[model samples]
Target: MKSCQCYLFRPPSIMSISSWVCLLPLIFYTCLAVGAKPASPQNVNVLSLNTNYTLTWDWDYNSSDALPVSFTTEYIPRFKLSSKRVVVWNMACEESPRRSCDLTPLDLHYLSIFILRVRANVNGSHSDWVQKKFCPDTDAAVGPPSKVDLGPAGGHLDVFISDPLTSANISMREELQELYYHILYWEKSEDTQDLRSRSLNSSVNMVTLPNLKSWTWYCVSIQTRYDFYNKFSSFTNPICMQTQGTLPWWQIVLYFLASLLVFFVLMLLILCGSFWCYRIVKLTLYPPIHLPKHFQEYLQDSPSSDVPRLLTPDSESELLCEVTVCPEPLVLEVHQPPPEDLEEPHPDLEPDIRHSRQDSGGSNDSGIYSTGGSSGLRPCPSLSHEGGRTSCQDIYDPQQVKMKDMTPGIRSQLIIDEGVLDMSV
Candidate 1:
């Protein structure tokens, strides 16, 4: 019965245009402040840990007026479309400026795809949710072999595997002990169906593939295995490698020795050719000297009446009178030696003379004289007249002359007047 008297409440009436103008700026500012929202988180990343996943993000406070932002995250199966959702709110990040959140006490499906969404609230103004889709086994599994080394070992491919990224958590460590490895390889030129596989225990990390074709390219992939769970992680990216070829130590040594032999032979040939060229050039540039036989004959010939007589240092008138009166021409006439006396031969000379005499018949000069050995002087057969002066002619022979110092300073003097000749005595 008392509710029948309920009265209606009404607000104050509109103010004048001048009063409204005064309140418009304050209302506008208040609306602007209330409507402003915090910027969405950027560089959102998720790191898988031994037993938990850490979600991290960053934002610039200077870019937006919204301050003191709070963050919340949600995870759901990427393929599931249920309307119901579950959220995990981070109280620590809401109270402080921390930018990270750790999700724990949950077991995620290893190979299942998941969708992660993150949103920020600044003074009850919410930002659009940032979403990411990834698989746990592919994006959240333990770190794979950090370093893989491949090399040739005794005509085989040697693969070295290490670093399965150890974990401090007891659960993760037990899982790691049960972890195995699957290795798959194939020839690059072959199809995908031609792949080959190998299973290795957890204790064995290194692998040796022997008897592989040399200089052939092969692609390889490796993945982690859980024997108890009967699960296998996604395969790692394929890596290409080539097997070593066959080369023996003896073959290398033989090659080296052959090269050295070739080099030595080439060097010897070059030296011999150079020597031959030098000999040829010397023969062409400098020739040997040889005298003709006619020159010796001319020197040995005796002068006849037709030839001019060698003039001696004597009276020309006496020689002419003798020649005109004699039946045969007077050969030569000599005068007394000059005032200058002749110096003795050098000390180095041995003045020994050897000669032989033979009777030559039917000649004015009856006896014939010839020299012997290397050094001697003798007169050849010649005509002789009745006068006291003998009419004779002698041929000079160079082999008869012997002097140790045959230098230019030493001289031999022979003088003649008409047919008459004289010698230094």
Candidate 2:
């Protein structure tokens, strides 16, 4: 395909009216001598938005002698900000040299202020930023809020502003009664403190969140506004917290069971110990007594007496000395006297000769002899059945009783009949 080329030419300064008619055909197809400069369009405003939103501008081909101007929409994010960016759109339409366009859901993350401009093109060329807007998104009646900050406490919100207003409110709607605000905030997490905890209408600048655990972290947003709902600006970083931990029901139940088990075990041990101590006490206090293995057999008299006789030989002196053996061991022997007999008497003297021994109970008594000296005397229990001599002369005096053999294993016990010795009670 072949392409047409445009050229520039200069026309003659003088031309006759009739003669010009013939040259008019050439002039019709010919180029103009000079082109005028483009017009300076009026500045357009970039509207502020609350929720993700968009703005559109309207312009038309109004210049009578000029060709249609092409329009391009340009946008900037975070105006006058360090993290600024430019955005482009493919919405170039060539209508009545007009601007008819739409923009929406402005990836709110980036888009801040927009600059819409139109360029007149007699040839393929661009104009300077014709409609420049330094403060694009600022409007007295309609604009986003300012000075927004973030909080980790997600539920409650806080907002700030430099100046005070007549009224303030928080809502999803952009238009409301004549209520302007200095600040606004939003809660993003669980809340615990009741709304009653706040004074009435005190929530105008400060906000509280809901559905949050104690000490849990959250993120909040805020700003200033003329209307109830508008975009929040000026933010701070997020804060953090560690919420309290909750124990499951199973763990509580296990703890209860463990405590109960310990208590029961202790009680059982106490009962068992008490019973054991009780059994031991009973066994000690009322011990079962039985006669020393065979002491009862000796209580009965023998059928015939074989016991030895004393040398005194008195008819009535046939007494037999009886010694007992207890389970508490002892040694049995005959003819021993107590150590008290060796002491001197009170000298209420009477010359001593052998006296006949008799049982006052009319039974029997035995007598002793001097084996060799006063220290080594011997005496024997006499059996009545011996039928031996009576009133023998070799009997020693009772005062001559001597000491006898000792048993290492025996602990002697003396149970004297003191009551029998006392005539007066």
Candidate 3:
């Protein structure tokens, strides 16, 4: 009756306490092993410059776990978080040992919103993922201008700015769409503290600085700025240039006038030299003729002198005569023509004959005589023939002889005999 009456539930026993105590540690160990995991990544961030993107995070590992730990980076568009369907994250880095991963390969849109996450893994156990929100156009830092150039205008300076570029050589302006420039300029001789600033619109690439001193050196630096994100970049290196100076109008005019004056002076000198050269050449080519002094005097003295008188004899001529004498005295016989055979001389010829005898001086002893007449003449008969001599009379007139028409020997003989005659017996 006592066994039948035993209940299905057993009463408390003394050894049950130790068994329960031993089983409690085993249950707690099983529960602890199931719940243990690696620490999650912390401080997850995205670094962006222009088109370049990087994902970074921090993780603290337990020293007691001697095994190495690795990290994984993933990304998902922020718009996908609100979708009714299941959303999956794209892997940026898988089991990477580094704390940072390059996200540029993903080619994320600059205008789209993205969620970036990182996690830590060790010994086949993974930690929870930490996330950060990023937008490249808004969160990325702008960079300085790629290039800066300066040009000199008249009393002015021209600044040319180029947009910043990414590591891949992509322009920041293409991504930003609203890029601005901040310009700082100062004179090289002035202190940097006295720099002047200028802000340019997004579309403007060139700017002119007016009211600058001429021939003065100026330095300029430019930076990129994004107003939507309030992001400003570091300024570029200073570029030095000089402003051009302009000449005064009066100086230009003076130079022109001086050049014109020089040209005119040169032309005048050339003309004078040419004229002098022409005169010298003309004189050398044709010379003037002049008459002799004696000829000129002779022509002036006698305008109508006869040719014969002009040919007067020289004053240095000398007349010569010779006389001959016979060696022996001999008797001469003369043949006398009869008086009836000879024609009688005319009465008018008697004076001429007497004058001729005086002119001849009875020099002829051969019974031959000449009469100075154009017609025929008769010889006189011998008057006596004795002592080897004959007397002869000749008619001669000096006025009737034409000396010009006679031979030179006869004229000379007549001239000699007229002055003096010599006879020998």
- Of the candidates shown, which would achieve the greatest lDDT relative to the real structure? 3
Backbone atom clashes (below 3 Å) for every candidate: 9, 24, 1
lDDT of 3 by residue, 1-425 (tens): 66755754557587997899999999998687557887888778888788788888777766316778888988999999999999998999999989999999888888899998888887778888888999887888888888989988788999988889976788887777788888887778656587665444435789897677898888888888888879899988988998888778998999999999999999999999999998898889966676785665564545454332233355223333467884432222111122322344433343332322223544332211244343222335334443554434444222322323434344223222322232111
Candidate with best TM-score: 3
List ranges where model 3 is wrong by over 4 Å. 1-35, 61-66, 166-168, 190-202, 247-425
| Number of clashes found in candidate 2 | 24
- lDDT computed for candidate 2: 0.39
When sorted by lDDT, best at the front, the candidate numbers are: 3, 1, 2
Residue 118, model 3, lDDT: 88
> Which candidate model has the greater lDDT, 1 or 2?
1
Candidate 1 lDDT by residue in tens digits, 1-425: 44544424334346666788899999999898788766888898888743457778887777566457777777766666444555443232333346776655345565577777677777777778787675655566554554566776655677676645534334343445666667766667667686665443443678876557887876667766655545555667878787767668998999999999999999999999999999999889977665565554444435333343454557455566543452432122122211112233223222343111222432211111233345333332454443434433444332244333333654644433322233431
Residue 15 CA displacement from its true place in model 2, Å = 13
Taking every candidate in turn, the Cα RMSD to the unseen true structure, in Å, is 22.0, 25.9, 25.9
Rank the candidate models, highest TM-score first: 3, 1, 2
